[model samples]
Target: MPTQAHINMPAEPVRQTGMLRPALTVFVGLSIVTGLLYPGVVTGIARTLFPHQAAGSLIVQNGRTIGSELIGQPFSDPKYFWGRLSATAPMPYYGAASVGSNLGPANPALTDAAKARIDALRAADPDNQAPVPVDLVTASGSGLDPQISPAAARYQAARVARVRGLPVERVESLIAANTEAPALGVLGEPGVNVLKLNLALDAAK
Candidate 1:
């Protein structure tokens, strides 16, 4: 015969079964809403609202992908206009490793790198004595800026014109044409898309 208290008391009082089902249900619901539904809706909205940007702002020419407008490229040829300096390790303009030199203005390493860039530019075009643009000698904050300041583009115009055997006026006109105005007329400074301009240069007859 069992005791009166044991007979009256509930079985498995210490087991956590009470919370197990509710917790599982809540977990499944939250996972569905957050992990699946939320991302799906956001992606759909982005694809619908901004297809170009949603597609990575890719620059396609002749059914081939040249690059993305969102990333910088290394252009060392004197015939092409170089964009801002990239401090990415292992390679210049390495997409996966976008990073600035993290050096202050007075840092000796920074100064040496800037001097090297200046020397390279001078060596490429010995006769051009114009002061180089600051953007050309310095890397942008992200080290992945696809566009260069308008002044930077203009600074390199003569060198590109001379090497390409194109008229300087023509090159300047190209620069003017490629110069992108500030977004919404106020969001950012005017910049020239270096890759597009170089592509145009190649396409010209």
Candidate 2:
């Protein structure tokens, strides 16, 4: 009451309101555009342009899905060409379990596995005098490799031919035909798709 000091203090500037509204609006807009719109457009384009690959590159026979060209299947029969060793667990070539053996060169487990595979191959083809191809005994990095080096295919050609009662020349020719050239003519080494080659063998019968 003592003249409340007639001292007047300037009122604080009105605090800025609604500054967050624009920021929130921008965040929502970008989320919708990038997360939803961008992916939808790209997927649609892929579906339209590369239908087969977009659909998983499936291989169908007689109205039934046999397998995918992109994934490997286990073929232990002597009459079929075998693919690389798969490290997938519980089941060979199980897509859900795609992985490498993760064994190093010095790992005894790897050495033993290679020896066992070599023994098995030798047992299967008692007459195959050619040195076994490395791919035949080694598991690929992904463990789901559908293809094998052409040399690996040839290593088993004689055995497959003998078992199927087909001429070695014919089996070799099939292998040649199934061999895929390096991508863009230089990206990768020649490889043969085991599943395709096996199916071709069946078809030739």
Candidate 3:
């Protein structure tokens, strides 16, 4: 028999080429749906439905912007109700650097920082005999958290009232007015947003 010519089967088509087509189609479709359409629709709905919140919950005073009800600011004066300690880097209450102290329970640095805050709070309101609330001494996970525990608010009542020259009962009433009940009456704690209380306090002046 004559020798048969050696034949090589054509190389199998590249498997990657087959994968590329389906992958590219899926990627393009998903990008448009999720990255563009979904976000756009949600943002539009929020702006139309919750205009104040969608606009950063900004608090305006006398045609000037003061702060947002969603973020806290540092106030060291006895006349002003203090917010939570900010762990924001480079400076306290720097909204752009919202972050926590990231210190574990046993961290000495955290212990010292917290102790300092406790001492200051005690010093500021010497007559206040109630135990310091943890929220008053520790920085929140998000340094921008605007609200404080109702206990913390009450703790500062006497000092702010005295400095502002308002009656303690009046300041307490303002704090009550600024208090927001738990979401659905159970999801979160009853708290007072510092920005809102401060704005109302200013209006009271």
Return the clash pairs for model 2, or none: none
- Predicted candidate 3 versus true structure: per-residue lDDT over 87-121, tens digit per residue: 99888889898899999999999899889988888
Better of 1 and 2 by TM-score: 2
Q: Write the per-residue lDDT of candidate 2 for residues 62-121, one digit (tens) a residue.
A: 999999999999988898988889999998898998899999999999999889989989
TM-score of each: 0.87, 0.89, 0.89
Per-residue error (Å), model 1, residue 199:
0.5
Please tell me which model should have the higher lDDT, number 2 or number 3: 2
Worst 10 residues of 2 by lDDT: 10-19
Q: Against the hidden true structure, what lDDT does model 2 obtain?
A: 0.91
Winner of 1 and 3 under lDDT: 1
lDDT of each: 0.90, 0.91, 0.89
Model 1 residue runs over 4 Å out of place are: 1-23
Worst 10 residues of 3 by lDDT: 9-18
